[model samples]
Target: MLKQIGNYLKSKWSVRLMTIFYLIAGFNHFINPDFYLPLIPPFFNSHEKINVLSGITEIVLGIGILFYPSRKYASYGIMIMLLAFIPSHVYFIQINSCIDGGLCVPEWAGWFRLVIIHPALLLWAWEAGKSSS
Candidate 1:
């Protein structure tokens, strides 16, 4: 079972899943603005506009990744986007893993996400862009 799962992850289906995941997550930024707004750091200007721009970029890149011609570029874009998001994650940690009126999690979980999950997410995006087939 583990080997099968591993094999599947290396297949094109993994990329498809990543694309769909981003698409839904991106759309959620618009559908539920409240969850995302608090994530933007206080130092950034025009929180609402930044949120909108982020959503649009995610949607565009997510869609762009599906095509053979654009997959590499889109993956790179996703990596860049993830890099751009480091500050937000850091801000989440600074706020003690609990945003006032927004997402709240165990303190360690925030660090775990920043240290572990973020890199894994980047790797996933990188893998999705590769022509492994």
Candidate 2:
């Protein structure tokens, strides 16, 4: 099963799909800034600098992942970024804060993020590396 999954990810469609996902996510960082604002850690709210930095990072990382030479690094960077954001998710759940003025993001959302999204991201990164190699 693992080998089959690996073989499937080696296809061009998989790479393109992963790239598209990053592109959408990166673009949405700007298009839907408010949606992500609540995910920022409170400690960084001393001023608005953190928000700008986060947006810039997302855009850069997204672009980096699209380029063949930098895709692997970008994948690693994205994985790191996702892991780093886990605390913010935890904080959101603990404080019962609404995500983008909507109802609180369900507790399971965080778990899904950690278990599903993060691992998928890591696999995407591995695929990126395989393509580059």
> 1-133, model 1: which lDDT tens digit per residue?
8556556654688878888988998999899999989989999999999889889999999898888789889989999999999999999999999987778999999999999999988877877777454
Largest lDDT belongs to which candidate? Answer: 1
lDDT of 2 by residue, 30-51 (tens): 7776777767777765324555
What's the lDDT for candidate 2? Answer: 0.69
Question: Residue 78 CA error for candidate 1 (Å)?
Answer: 0.1
| Stretches of model 1 off by over 4 angstroms after superposition | 1-10
Q: lDDT value for candidate 1?
A: 0.87
Listed in order, each prediction's TM-score against the native is 0.90, 0.77
Alpha carbon lDDT at 55, candidate 1: 92
lDDT of 1 at 81: 95
